[model samples]
Target: MGELAPTVAFLTGAPTQGRIGVGWRTLRGLLGRPAETPTLTVAEVDTHLGDVATTSGSGSAARRSELLSHLLARATSAEQDFLLRLLTGELRQGALEGVMIEAIATATGVPGDLVRRAVMLSGGLAETAAAAASGGREALLAFRLELGRPVRPMLASPAESLDQAVEGIAEPIVEYKLDGARIQVHRDGDEVHVYTRTLREVTRQVAELADLVRGLPCASVVLDGETLALTDDGRPRPFQETMSRFGSTREEQVKALLLRPYFFDCLHLDGTDLLDASLRERREALHRVAGEHVIPGEVAPSDPAALLESSLDAGHEGVMVKDPDTPYAAGRRGRAWLKVKPSHTLDLVVLAAEWGHGRRTGYLSNLHLGARDPDGGEPIMVGKTFKGLTDELLEWQTRRFPELQRGSDDWTVHLRPELVVEIELDGVQTSTRYPGGVALRFARVLRYRPDKEAADADTIDAVTAMLRG
Candidate 1:
């Protein structure tokens, strides 16, 4: 979901990504306890949540800052730590979304599926929880696919090869997997709204796209698709070029990077919802409504290899092989859709590591990967992954990294950037999360490179080049 929630910024102007507007040393001074600490109750903290949690508060910036100072001044050491982690979105007590859904079901005596489905449609866990508490199952069941409101798009799981992707499916619906931005566009007559895969509305930023969708033949429709900037030859431009338009309102930039939509699935059309419909039925509706805008593919191809080859030749990332009989499962990675691509590998340096929990307790599990700076500066971090490590590898790292440790914090162990490991990734994409302005996509550890030095690692330019691959 890194593509969805790229960064977390708080209403207090504090951030876990981008620049640090407030100095940490200045804030740390507030965490220090007074000679005699005063009692700060949970009731006092609850009263401040509404004022500071929203950006539209009527209070002045200085007034809000003063409130925060008083709150932190009376907080116990543990309470201060909890507040910092909660605000920064670093609080992890093992209560995942699924766990909370199950808890709500248990408390309200509503079926878990009903609560989950309501959450998927409403896009708010807090709202669903309130509904379940007030009216039980009836309130949850009342939620439906609303026009102009975007639902969570279904995701594709990765496959090693085309053969593996189509192994058991009888008649697969395979389409070109473009390396572009995923958009879920909803049209209600002349008012068309477009949303990112994360369900954020960007219709204003992509006004031209709105115009195109508004012109579609249907009255009310929901289309799931990919949109990317294309060259004059109709070949896909670099992914960065496509992603740039989503974050900006600059007229010239929007004009320069025009995105073309290629829809693959239709979830709703006219007056009917297709949430429980099979792909065979939905695909037919998609062709009837989208016409030329429907993504090109075949059902039960004689040579899927050639289909994948054609996708690559046309400057796309790969192909998505999907099951034709399965219903759309929103917000989850069902077994129906799978992505296949050529294997990509890179030798990256380990910049830092995070301590693991659960079965991986007492060891560093997630790795912070980086690429070499060609100009002889510090290494630029690309991404992190603990995907392909074995238990033995975890033990080795836990024992070995302490020797190369440079510093430590509550979350991550900083290293000297001397160790290099080979990584296998799906590809690289333009990202604002790292210093290099790029991040590795779907990366996993391959093996440690004992013979390689930090100088032998791949450069940032080479990593960015994979955006085209």
Candidate 2:
């Protein structure tokens, strides 16, 4: 999944299925070779042996030499080329682990669910495949949750509106949509481990959080929640501050801005696994065990708008309307949970201006926008936009952008970041390309905010909070 763009592009453009196949026929056409030698066997390619007939492992280097000699001795020029690509990691078959699980299940006569379950628990496809083939269904199902191993967290899908979110659910749990990081806490005896949404362990970095979890009554438990930095008044800090603290490893920095966890679901309590249980059941278990840390939420409300207002008043992003009967389906962004946040406009700094294209050529277009950093640092880029710009605005920017130029690249004119512009966007999405870990979606310029300075620009935290919507 983390493959480089060029590699992924090459693989995507390669012929993988139907019509054009990567066989010896194609190999002969490409390399102008014939199979003058014997076909390479699985044993020869999988492991090194002196020869097909020879099997001796007396010397480590000698054994490897023998294996390579035996394998290459049988391989044709085209076959050797294929081997080189495989060894160099250039032969991307364009298949994920999901495909391999299906193949294993089909080959071993095991159910796909059993194979998946084994893979999830074992955390390795090769290991899971071996177990399924050798020990069958019983062995696959035996794979259970370990204390430190992280399971995939459940995700939520975006909803159009609050009414659309709670349309079908009988008793939706309206929980405050905290503008924070998703945290998965696993408490096994005295050891407490914390994981991010991506399942990266930050046990040492969030030591205080672990200490708080240690106070919980249960000896072993797995809780899903959100963590945020809070002020002395007990209000949640901006997401930027929360992330800055969350990502810190220094002792003093971590202590300076401690994060508070607001748990909402319990996947495991004591020895019982409640992954297959309903949301209502999980919430009940969570309240019983960590009631003090449970996030503020209520059953189906008659006045959701009022609840939403209260949420905003408390400095929360919005409200999450969740179905009470749905099972915890990890790794899936389903409709069971829906977040609702009112749309708002922001005044952002123009970092740069990009040259236009086609109808907009020769004019300064695609304004690069950035949000303010709370630490009095440089503006962090959120996104760029060329939309909602009239010809007059384009002409004005073309003449004005150069005056505010700090530098200029081939296609972009870097600005002084002194110009503040108002932007209206649908929301923000999690992004790796941007410095703020978020990017604006469907952003359009409302107007230039000449009244406000770059110092008065909205923060990265405010932009990130739109992710809840």
Candidate 3:
């Protein structure tokens, strides 16, 4: 009951056996096992669900199809309908699983916060719910930061100015915020895994970085940091250059565009979980095992503005002002950490795009941008721009956006709200043109946020807040 395999099955919707692809329509047409056979039990169905995740061979897909057909065949009609819904990702047992935390707390009499924290650290609501229901609060609270399973990362709220960023935070720790991809590294002996800010494992793509962490002086540790490709002079390459390395596993491709790691915070060290420790304590732990590998920063500097200039002069993005007294707030964004970039940027979703003209002919040029709706609704359009697309980017968009297209016209291609892009703008202005009653001023594309999804885009609330002052 605690296993996440079934949940994973529910989420992925289908197995990796693309060759023997099975969809609802295909399954509906196929015959199942004999009707006289004994009905499938819950435990037997669980076994099949677990095996579907890792069962791969030259002929494994057909075997998996048989298992699913048999499970459905022996089930009651109602149960069969439920299984089909789960396979199609339409089973909303709770609104996308977050509601399950509250349900578990209510049923088990354990705290909802306890269940949520356990889920965040363990990355499995099923396991946490089982523990809570079986052994109550003590077992629910027993979940620790697992080494390999990626925990949801803490995020930062964007600040309007440097003073505003550090206004209420105490004993600020100013670290150079380099323009790079965020990474979470887990090291256990010689085995190491590297995950992106979204918690997707990229260890296979960046195995060299994993090897570097394996050499660090720690038996088991988890470090939060950033990685980027640097020039021969040791300056960061463009953000696009760094991101281009995340999807490849080729030896020549990986080796040619090598990435370097810069650790900032330690979440675990030497068998102790540091998730509850202060940033100062965690930074010390980070320095102990990764002195040379730590990100460059100072604790409560007298001249934080000067440091910001130095960061910019050195070709970095800006400085991150952090509160040294704060603990690692996993999976939440609060005032403890603030990013101060030179210009304003918002992560917006691409609602659609218009075909190009003139020199931009044959490419998708102008993009329609939309801010996320916090009420679980579709994205609300704020503005459109073709101001920042380079030749390479235009070509990439023309190729990429079509794959995600939902519907299109002669000039504009409407798409599913899938690609999140970074946008830099002067400010927001009141406007009736958009549903949010606010529009971005002089907006230009900064970069595409491949690491983010539509849900993670800056909310309409965040965008409208800029119009306040």
What's the TM-score of every candidate structure? 0.69, 0.58, 0.82
Where is model 1 more than 4 Å wrong at Cα? 1-47, 55-59, 92-95, 344-469
lDDT of 2 by residue, 174-286 (tens): 99988787888999999889988756688888999999999999899999999999999999986657766655689999868989999999989999988778999999999
Q: Which residue runs does candidate 2 get wrong by more than 4 Å?
A: 1-130, 133-136, 344-424, 427-469
TM-score for candidate 3, please give it: 0.82
Q: How many backbone clashes does candidate 3 have?
A: 0
Query: Poorest 10 consecutive residues of model 2 by lDDT?
Result: 12-21
Q: For model 3, how does the per-residue alpha-carbon lDDT over 389-458 read when each residue is reduced to its tens digit?
A: 9998999999987866667899999876768999999999999998889989999998998888665788
For model 3, the run of ten residues with the poorest summed lDDT: 11-20
| lDDT value, residue 152 of candidate 3 | 76
Which of 2 and 3 is ahead in TM-score? 3
Question: What C-alpha lDDT values do all the predictions have?
Answer: 0.76, 0.73, 0.80
Tens digits of per-residue lDDT, candidate 1, 105-191, equal 998999998888887887656667767887899999899999988886687765656897899999998899987888999988787
Note the clash tally of each candidate: 0, 1, 0
> What residue runs in model 3 are displaced by over 4 Å at the alpha carbon?
1-108
